[model samples]
Target: MNKWEILNHAETACYQEEREVLVRGDRRWITALHYAFQDDNYLYLAMDYCVGGDLLTLLGKFGDHIPEEMAQFYLAEIVMAIDSVHKLGYVHRDIKPDNILLTADGHVKLGDFGSCLRLQEDGMVHSSLAVGTPDYLSPEILRALESREGYGPECDWWALGICAFEMLFGSTPFYAESLPETYGKILHFQEHFEFPPLAAAVSAEGRSLIQGLICEPQERLGAGGALDFWGHPFFSGVHWATLHHCTPPYQPTVSNGTDTSNFDVVDDCLSRMEALSGMRGSQPAGAHLAFVGYSYMATGETKDCSRDTVMSTDKQQSGDSEGLIRDNLLTESVSEELPKPFEHHLVLSKGPAGHVHGDDTDLDAAMTMELHRQLQEAEQRSRGLEEEIRQLQGELESLRARRLTELNIHEPHLFLPAHRLDATGDGKLAPPACHYPLVIRLHRHLLLFHRVWRPGVTGESYLLVCAAGVELQAWSRQQSAELS
Candidate 1:
């Protein structure tokens, strides 16, 4: 596959996703233009022309590691992209350092979709021909390739873990000279780091990330899992909005035009690869037909070959009028292997069809209004419940205080019944009770209290209690009346 091929697939994938997942955003948006083929067999992707180079180059100019907070910002965006692709029934077969690109302000954009796969809706079993960068292959993928079994998106997670590890440590956890050797290490190896010794030299947040990224695919973050991982304590205080807005805390070192030009061959090869890979630039090919057509020889015969040679085109199908190339021979050909193209039955189209472009302000205002309405309703309900609770609590407290005071006036700062002297000694001389001393503070609030007394009233014995701010002030004695 070359640049032209890659761009065609990318355009197809972009259009397909536009219907289901991709949408206009608060900032940058990706739109696919028609593919242009270069004479040198390289496809020049006239994409949005993001000025920021590939993520690998950015990491190279900076240190091998990024701050955990900064990394979370990038990861959050990646997770969103992945989720969007996933919802459209696609899985990014290749997730690696080379595939992620950053814009001028450091916004990470997922660029290459050359290895995405689209699954069947029925949840039946299917096989994906292993097509991804080697180091990131999951253990299940390695097992499937080696054992000739089925594998799924779990393989992508394996790659994500390796990618995360490389970001921190500058290299993959498993590396080897040959494919088999690399797969062996990934499957059987135990990941043991120097722990606090090595990580202590790094930030605590960075250390936590390394631990998660090197784990087995089954145990690693998947889908919503990455969001939770980014929310960890290591990412505390990170300005997510600023980071998303392309305001990186630190800038990556810049490479001159000369250095970027050196990768012309790379760009060419990727374009060609994209065309031949037969996947939508962002997803798997439309159906199993292209795969089936590529799987069998024109004569409908199977061929046995080595892994490396499998990538080369054989002359057997070149002369055939049908232009069909059978690529894989291991699986048995079945009737359901080939399906009709998606557009024939789905009846759906994507992207803009007209030029009514000035509705952004209206849309924003509508969203704001809806949010405001919901907030107002929630606040009103909360206030009403709070007021009711306060009123009930106040009544209950008042009743409890009054009853307790009447039962125990001897207690400090409690109200007591009014008492008078019995002059006859027969307890029948109830005379008119007269005036009492009243204290008014400068604040114009009355301070009322009760005086204590004895049985006979001939002798003087007493106790007094005063009231203060919402509580009992103190107990004091002015004079004493002895008991009869």
Candidate 2:
């Protein structure tokens, strides 16, 4: 029941083990350091230990707003570290200030992967059990526990955006009275910032980069897509390759620089990640790939798809801290309420062949302000109505799917919502009642299966129904009750 002791022991063990493992890079550079014990309740982690301590401690000493130069250096370093971890095919699910450590020599060392998992291997959507600090969590993460079974690399990028925002501003963009409220704000995409301070301090391009990083996963940059964001105008003069080469940007706070007493355990633990990365490509020929879903491209496969063109249906949104979907009007309304510099701009590409879009600059500043106010009020009203409509639509879809799956109906046209039969006593003809009734049919040739889900008035329901398997006979609740 006492978690403090457990946490302290785990934290100490992780710190100690990481101190000893130095091959090409330290534990900070090693994202997944798997260490288990004979007892196996908690695993020891030998990760990179920066002498300066975590970002939380640093913030306490110097306040939340970091120096611009230091912030840029720290942000850039973290981005590269993230790139390395993701390349190895994993996501550091819990990214926050407390996880980032500053070495004695003034360089940033990203640590803590206790919540880390091989994102490519473990396909999750979101978790109900909250992990990591609230302020630093992505909108999706904040809502889902770290266990939800479907998010991809975009989740990590969302966390990185929060980190960057915290580095520049003393406060987080999203916060509320309670965790549930905070989650609601994130789900609704309600985030705001003051212009006078952060705007005065950071560059236009730097702000743009932040916007790109914080958006919805579909809107946010991908792991490989991140390189382009880093190479943008914000970091025009910065050299990333040279920076990554520096083993230690600053001196480690540990007094003895040559300390190797703990190296064996650390090195042993770090090697597991190396083994995992190596083994990923060595699957047996014609290996059966598990089908999680079609949305996640890496997990599921389609026969006609080309390697490069197996594009994902979901597009990540930029500036989304929680990795949740935003109302299109929320951004527009917020942009109108804010000043010109704070206005949201579409990150469109140039050239005849590229994505080109025009800015609404023809209207005078005064007229624009008036238009913005009108738009915000109108959007707020529209979003409220839209939310109700969406909820109703979702409920209707769920009812239809449940009816089709439960009855094992094979008619594709019957699945259509518009044509769906109203079975709610609205004078609709009820099917002839019979014993063991409700015929079901499915394509046995289609071996593929997907997890079936239904949300009810009480809570969500889940059933892993097979694509080919249909329930031929139903033992109704009345029959079961009579048997009992």
143, model 2: CA deviation in Å?
A: 5.1
lDDT of 2 at 22: 18
Which digits, one per residue and each the tens of the lDDT, describe model 1 over residues 71-189? Answer: 55665566555544554566666788777765433456676665655655642114434567778776666666557665555555556656666666667777788987886777775
> What is the TM-score of each predicted model, taking all chains together?
0.45, 0.45
Where in model 1 is the C-alpha error above 4 Å? 1-45, 67-69, 122-125, 146-152, 191-197, 223-226, 239-243, 252-484
The count of backbone overlaps in candidate 2 is: 39
* Candidate lDDT (C-alpha), each: 0.46, 0.48
- After best superposition, candidate 2 residue 189: deviation in angstroms? 2.4
State the lDDT at 136 in candidate 1. Answer: 79
TM-score of 1: 0.45
